[model samples]
Target: MAASLCYMNPTMIVTTSHRSSAELWRQAEEWAQRIGARAVRRQGSLAHLCELHEADGVLTITNDRLVYREPASGLEYFFHPGMAKVRIHNIEVGRGDPMIGAMQLRPGDGLLDCTVGRASDAVVAAYVAGPQGHILGLEKVPVIAQLTIHGLATYEDSSRKVTQLLRRIEVVQADYNDYLPACADDSFDTVYFDPVFHEPVEKSEPMKPLRELADKATVTAGALQQALRVARRSVVIKQRYGTPLWDQLGITQVLSSRSSRIEYGIAEP
Candidate 1:
């Protein structure tokens, strides 16, 4: 199905700055138009929807409110909707396997995924946290943002297993900067940053897709700096064996996720 889009009350807004909330929404709306996301319906304050693309889900501009709704659980999440050419990674392990990220989670932990991308990790984080915990996702690409929200929307009607899992998940289409400040200080126990995976190539640099989209994340830095500051416990940085999450964001230890490159970061105690 084609993705849908909406104005979420068409907030009292103005094009204040180059990248203000309204302006971002306007640009995002234009992109959504180019694609085919439609307005689904008005559920309370939010315009809930379905049929979203991956890029649509990543470019949201929320005005601080999280549009929390009841969740239903028994559904399998949908990741990467329309991308055709799947280039195989040299590593045997797939990047989206939730088990690889187990170390980044703890029972009852409130976790946030800043660089959500297609949001495979967000679904895993929510399931890992279980019932007592909460999962919040932030994506900034219009197509990806729509797809992610559609996943979250499906949770609203999940059966037994799905209901249990969906109860803890909250997904939104806002910039990390807007979302982070809205949360109280120390709101999360852990924050996860998987700054895309890059491997060496003989020619002069990296591979294609990862080399491209990995560099597009804005939330990674904001998520790292602010996620650490607002986290009550610590932050988890996911990177390939040799790649670093810059200088300031370092972990005390690592866990090999049964993959050659994908590694987990456990903050120092």
Candidate 2:
């Protein structure tokens, strides 16, 4: 169970669970009691806002949901679009996380990290290939951009493994809608997307922080079309193991590590 509980305000508590799906709910309730904070479980995320006491806090059961939370980090990490939600296990940044562990990064290559929340994947990729390669992390939210820059700059000072390995990362605070055009045609080798994890519109929701952002940005097939447009090599979509992505898009399932199934959509040659 990967969960954290902290006081967001004098009265409210934010509990985050980033582990096994089955254990996430049980751990969330436990964290709430351990810290005496209000617990909001992020299950069946489809609505714009989950039930909350304040005007803030939206629903977020997927990477897409967090993107709307961008621009707001540090201390509370409020501006992050969420972490590098990928699957490539055994890599230090997101070790054992199949969503983060199953990445296919070759050495001495460049990758456009669509959402560089905490830069977990950027650091891991940089380490994998060495300094000849570069990673451009695009973020629309100012808070997340600033945090990523600061964190990447200071990463060397904190963890020797990451510090020596992450010198090639570049963090940019720009909406992808605007920046994707700047890249030359077929410029990048990979375009990775962890779109918001939303439930069917009618299901009951569990997370409150994600409610507001969901109202602002709707993660439909059209949004994903944008991701497909900007990539040259492959588009990687992260989702549940058994979930069928055909309803969302026509992505060919290409990789799977543990339970984090990765589907790839390659542009026509």
Candidate number of the best TM-score = 2
Q: For candidate 2, which ten residues in a row score worst on lDDT? A: 1-10
What are the candidates' C-alpha RMSDs?
13.6, 13.5
TM-score of each: 0.52, 0.54
Q: Per-residue lDDT tens digits of candidate 2, residues 1-269?
A: 01012113223333343433545555445534543445565433312123343323321222222222221211123332123323222554445544333346667767777666556667666666567877788765443455466556644343455566545688887656556656666677666654344443223132223322222232235545555566655656554344456455555544554422333333221
The number of clashing residue pairs in each candidate reads: 34, 30
**Residue ranges of candidate 2 with Cα displaced over 4 Å:** 1-75, 78-103, 156-158, 199-229, 242-245, 257-269
User: What digit string (tens of lDDT, one per residue) describes model 1 on residues 17-62?
Assistant: 2234544556446534633443222222221222121111222333
**What are the runs in model 1 whose C-alpha is more than 4 Å off?**
1-104, 155-168, 200-215, 218-223, 246-250
